[model samples]
Target: MHSRAVFMLLAAFALGACRGPKSDCEGSYESWTGSMAAHDWDSAYELLTPEFKKKVGSPKRMAAYMEDSWKGSKSFEFSPFDIAETNAGVCTARGEMRYTVKIRGELPKDHEQVYFSYVFRQEKDGLWYIELPGNERIQSF
Candidate 1:
């Protein structure tokens, strides 16, 4: 009876800790965007895949390239993602997001809507990292 109770306790802990891939990815993506909205480039950069950072160059360069994109972005939010998962466990989540940016010399309370695709890859440790995003080099502005 004691062993069964211990097993139940362990199972409960495990289940509680596992938020599932979609939830985890959503949290990570939201956190990344939150950092970008706050203009914490390095913090946002850290959430990207290693390969993306390599392709985009250092964090400073990436920030420089994206500065304009974020500079006028007063606020932003994305809709629910349509997540696609492969048998190998790779997932790509895409959604349309609205941005409030400075268009031209004026800062608008609302701007155009854009699309962002979050490419997710599971590492050996079974943790997923966002491999790419439409806001990044993968898609056009």
Candidate 2:
């Protein structure tokens, strides 16, 4: 009876461990975007893959680039319209986002709307990380 109980417990744990992200892809994408929208660059950078970090040089450089691009932004909004995952541990999220940038020395704000698609890959650690293109920005953007 003791051996049976131990086997059952191990089986349960194995099953739970095998359960991976499917619908949760959107959730992961939201967490990353939320960090960026809040200007929490460090938190946002943590969601990227190691390859992306190496390509960007370092976390500080990545943050600086984001700051420069979003310099005059007053508000940002993002909504994921579609999220898909493959059995190979690759996922893609497509969304529409807008940023309201306050023009320097001007009263008016510039609203830029962009459609973006991001690729995420699940690594050996069972955590999903953002996979960015060589140019950084999404192709549709």
Candidate 3:
């Protein structure tokens, strides 16, 4: 009976810890998406890993890429359609985004919508960050 009670207690703790971390991760991703949707480049870039920031070289270059890919936009939003996580701190997220943008006029138009999937890994700081495949092969400058 004592052993069974101990097992139950350990199981409860494990479950609780798992639940808490998952929720926090979800919240973090949500915040990340929100910042990106608003084109808050600084805020979104702040959430990126040091390696990612370094790879992009500077905020100016990063902004240029982001703007080119997402320019003249009125609004952008992401809805997480799926998420998968493994015990090794590797995670994958799939989502769809809607963006409203203007090509050259004052009135914005919904021109691009895409479904994206991202792979992330937890850093030493225990924060999840995006890691792209073949990122090393791509030179920033």
Candidate 4:
């Protein structure tokens, strides 16, 4: 109940504090995180940029990777984010992400806050999508 309240407040703050492209980025990002938190890999995969999907190969592979990657994850919420648009269609958001991770046979770790900087690209369709690093090895993306 407490976590849900916090999530609601964060969602309100994230959705309420913007206009224009940044708003779109925030919305897309919120959707992405929400899907991931719900373990809706199919929806999350659909939000990734085509380029990212190509790099990751099929949705099945992406799901497999995310399944392993998110094994200990509980919930996640974004802090205030700032977007910088360098190129016409590219932008980057810098902020903190708070989440929980539970290790097997251990007490759940809660409210782990970490700084995050992520790239976003607005496709020709005028929708923002996640863009991972060019190198596939980086976990940050």
Candidates 1 and 4, the one with greater lDDT = 4
Model 3, stretches more than 4 Å misplaced?
1-23, 106-108, 111-113, 132-141
**Highest TM-score against the true fold, candidate:** 2
- How accurate locally, in lDDT, is each candidate? 0.63, 0.69, 0.63, 0.69
Q: How far in Å is the alpha carbon of 91 misplaced in model 4?
A: 1.7
Q: lDDT per residue, candidate 3, 1-141, as tens digits? A: 999999999986563333221234565466466656666565556556567878888767766777786677767777788777744666667788888877774766775557877665566878776554345222212
TM-scores of all predicted structures? 0.64, 0.70, 0.66, 0.70
lDDT of 1 by residue, 45-108 (tens): 6666666767778879867866866777867776756766643546666787787867687647
lDDT of 2: 0.69
lDDT of 2 by residue, 71-99 (tens): 77767788778888854667788888888
The RMSD of every model to the true structure, in order and in angstroms, is 10.6, 11.5, 13.2, 7.9
Backbone clashes, each candidate? 0, 0, 0, 0
Candidate 4 wrong stretches, greater than 4 Å:
1-23, 133-141
Give the per-residue lDDT of model 4 (tens digit) for 1-141: 999999999986564332112237767767666766666676667777877888788879878888898888877777756866756666667888788889989999876558777677788788888765443223332
Q: Model 2: how far is 6 from its true place, Å?
A: 45
